[model samples]
Target chain A: MAVTGMQAELTLGPIPFHWSREEKRDFYARIADEAPVATVYLGEVICSKRAPFFETEIPETAERLERGGKRVVLSSLAEVMLTRERKATADLADMDGVEIEINNAAGLLARAGRPHRVGPFMNAYNEDAIAWLARGGATHVCLPAELPGEAIAVAARAAAALGVEVEYQVFGRAPLAVSARCYHARAHGRTKDNCQFVCEEDADGMPLATRDGRPFLRVNGIQTLSESYVCLVGEAGALAKAGVGHLRLMPQAVDMVGVARAFRDCLDGRKDPAEAEAELVGLCPGTRFSNGFYHGVAGYRKIAADAAAMADR
Target chain B: MTQAELVCPAGTPAALRTAVDAGADAVYCGFRNATNARNFPGLNFTPEELAEAVAYAHRGGAKVLLALNTYPPAGKTALWREAAETGARLGVDAFIVADMGVADHVARTHPGTRLHLSVQAAASSPEAIRYYCESFGVRRVVLPRILTIPEIRAIRKEIPCEIETFVFGNHGLMVEGRCSLTNYVTGQSTNMDGVCSPASDVEYVRSADGSMSSCLGGVTIDRFAPDEKAGYPTICKGRYLAPHRAEGYYAFEEPVSLNLARMLPELVAAGVHAFKIEGRQRSKSYVRSVVSAFRRAVDDIRAGVAPDLADLVALTEGQKETQGAFRTKKWR
Candidate 1:
């Protein structure tokens, strides 16, 4: 089944949860020492309220990752609403010493004409956007998780033509929305300002269920994520063939190092996709795996393969 | 000239006419496709209808702005470009755009066409608004509903372009252009597909107990008592259950409409250039009633009279309204 010669690299996405400083420090240390990821993104991509806690640890973590021979990109907030958030985005854009990835429209102006990465939150959905961002110094782009495999293939091709690298999240709970209001704080009968770091209690984010008692989503401060982790292990062959140069694995509470190794094994043809899928299920025992968004179906469903892609092949 | 111009929505030609006759300075409508946000069936105008609508609005001494806001999907941007060109050719006053590519194309191709940055761009900060203004010569920006009055005042001092604020209609609590809660449960996307909890996929089941449950796709968003009014199943306004609250609660936001009817003077004092009303999918009578009421309110404020707007509450979602985020940090 592994008939392609092209190999895809793996990237570690930023943590979407609010973990303690020691927890974050230990995670980064392990990643620097043991994980097989090529690039690591560090930042508070969700809520501005959670930024103050771990913002100081970013420089140190980036340095540690750099020592481990990994490319480090500092990501700006996915939603830049507050005045202080805008200032922080501008300040990060002005820093030329480190590579930066901008997620919001606020960072686009200052970061223009210089090299930077584009996060999925920017919604790089079409070719024209990819081409436009390329002109504005976007050397790399992590396409949004909602895009199907066919759409991603089209975007990857457009990005490849511009010499821009494309990264797709192949694992981790997909981020569905970012709101100005914090659901996590609201659940505890508290506002975001007085959240009291309530989100820190659930290291993997608080579980949210539908009215029918079906577990559907995870609430992490202002961000709403899918209950099912996006697992595109089955599509690894097609993804590599589609010119997707890098596969992203978002940071979760699971054994991410093992998860990275498994995906790397499948992409590198060292392990069968089914074998890797089994390993993923073992590593993330609490959640189900879904490839629905990749198959042009509901993001919560677990479709096996793209029938349209199979027909085309 | 009045202190601020009022921009109203027109889902159809009749609504367009209704908005103008009700004292709207400008009316915004979209083509019947994914090029705009409210791309529902039986809503929006066709190209020919738009030409007629523009002519009719101009005859009534009002400007018509065409919304081409939704982000075009990968490998399929031509539809959006053609829509923009057709709107420009039809003599629409301005184009409300969200995606940078569409804005870029409009700026370079139709050099003098006025561009208003849609709230779908989610550019809430002054720097973000400035980026759009400087990059594409955007004349105005529909500020996201996530800002406070003071925050809006602070932004007004920094940006180079005119700012438009929503004074009535849906309490859009989510940061626009970025939220994807609808996409997870339903296959349709608000950003790319231009539909959120699309009507085709929504179902309401009545319980044997005379209560009702609203479902988006196969998942239930909220349950209602027999006497409670059922609203559209917007994912953000849905009730959900968590460990902290065994009983379900409105985790993101409740089903309430944003009515800034009482705060007109303060918004005008903040140097707002336009007041926006956000019901593109509403009925003709709704357009007539709401627009006329707001019309009187705007005029009353100008005449230095206190406007009585209590009657407008009967038209809000859940028959309830909120001055969300504008009054205070509802959820700091």
Candidate 2:
């Protein structure tokens, strides 16, 4: 059932970048005090080597967010390759009084029979997979970023029928792939084990450019992300109408609180879609925005909402 | 010590026969459709071809593993289901699957059928492997090409099912089944359509300065000098410039093939049950040479003798090879 006004919830996804412990704490502190998102996902979803740096700060951050009337969920790694990572995932599953989001299958195995959320990294492409995950105690599922609009609508409908909430990534650089070999270390001519944690230097990520000088992708240690940010402020109403329960906003090195407000204004119909797009561009200046994956085109192509509307007419 | 089975690729009936004749313990092939990962045109077997291949492998005491590994799109799962049913009817030795729905279908509908989890599932941990073993009765899991021998040994001790690792062919450093870089450029995805950098959209351009470049979907992926060997235009192996770096380099991975011929003994000693060779789209002669070389290496290890390392650098992608995360976790 689609409500008339602001029915879809705004969720802040876990930070995929390698931010320092203090920086992470400060970001969440700002988010808790200011951002209008309903849920805040915490914990390291990228490299496990960076986990201990912020291990002590996770609880405090989650507590602060909960105190701010926001629901907190601990997110697991997108890829579990080492033994310690597996143990850490199992430990996350064993935690009490906190919801968990399983990004990989190891999390599902560790947290089976318990209500949890499935992150975008775990493939929930088809209805059968969605129903299977729901039966295994998944309360929420985020569709992958590459899914077209029609597939998203179908998956959202399937989730509704299975009594599961469906979430979609609406902002930031889409995480394309993750690997065990650290690209940041490789780019710096260091190995993953002795890399000296070089990824911390790049707050957002190491921007990769094509040979011809076009910015193509960002190498964030083990994860590769798009150079363009996925902005769907204009599609919030259509997404909500298609039964999407939440729009996940990925963290970037920008004014995320302002970004959240822009999305909220657009979703609530307080700002015109075109104006919201312009405001988003102004907020994150010099960032390329794309929603072509949602439009069944190349992911880098930015299809203007006004142009689409006029074409339909 | 149990000799690790040699699992080889077979894109056609001829390749299947060559692999079996060359001493592959099991040959994996897929039907001619998007239901399988190697869904390229002029590749893969039809149902009748698969039935004959299965029979031929059975006669030679080799196994036929049907690969139905692609993730079916939402509301379009009947194709995968039909693939599984057809594979079962043709008496495939096992069904290699990646999607949970396909695994569930094979496990429920075809009871007593052997299920091997494809590497596309990206299950690396003991908990993840055990979960599949517990839920779908998966007998084997093709491990992602991202783990070291020591890590695989640790996992083998903890999980319940058998382990399979790639010993040769394309080093897909990116996490399998989770990558969308190809889809971002080409609108077709490996998970959804079993295609990555589809041949239809690939282009090779020769510059006037005696240099060549490979392009995928009109985006230049990599440039090679006349003296250098150019590789397939996969996005991961592309050379790119970064702000932190001055010159262009492979930001993700270099164009190299995984050659674990020297690490076969260690992998076998680590309790790995199978060694997979990655190229189903290759020619029959390529299959024969690789399968035969690995077969001798596996046999030599089992016989307590050193494996005579065959020179396969010429057959490698970009004429380069690496151990690739098997000897160490730091190979980028």
Best-fitting candidate, scored by DockQ:
1
For candidate 2, write residues A1-313 as lDDT tens digits: 4433388999999999889888898999999999999999998999999899998888888999999989998999888877779888999987778898998888888787799999998898888999889989999999998887778888888889888999999999988888888899988889889879999989888898877677888889989999999998888778888888799999999999999999999889899888888999998888899987887777877888887555334
DockQ of each: 0.76, 0.73
Question: Which residue pairs show collisions in model 2?
Answer: none
lDDT of each candidate versus the true structure: 0.87, 0.88
lDDT of 2 by residue, B1-332 (tens): 85599999999999999999999999999999888888899999999999999999999989999999999888789999998888999999999999988888899999878999999999988888888898899999999988889989999999888999999998897889998898888878888889888999899999999888898888888888999888889999999898767688888877788888878889999999999999999999999989988888888888999887755433464567899888876574
Off by over 4 Å in 1: A1-6, A306-312, B308-318
Q: iRMS for model 2?
A: 1.2
Tell me the chain A TM-score of model 1.
0.95
The predictions' CA RMSDs to the true structure, in order, are: 2.1, 1.9
Clashing pairs in 1: none
Candidate 1 lDDT at B60 equals 94
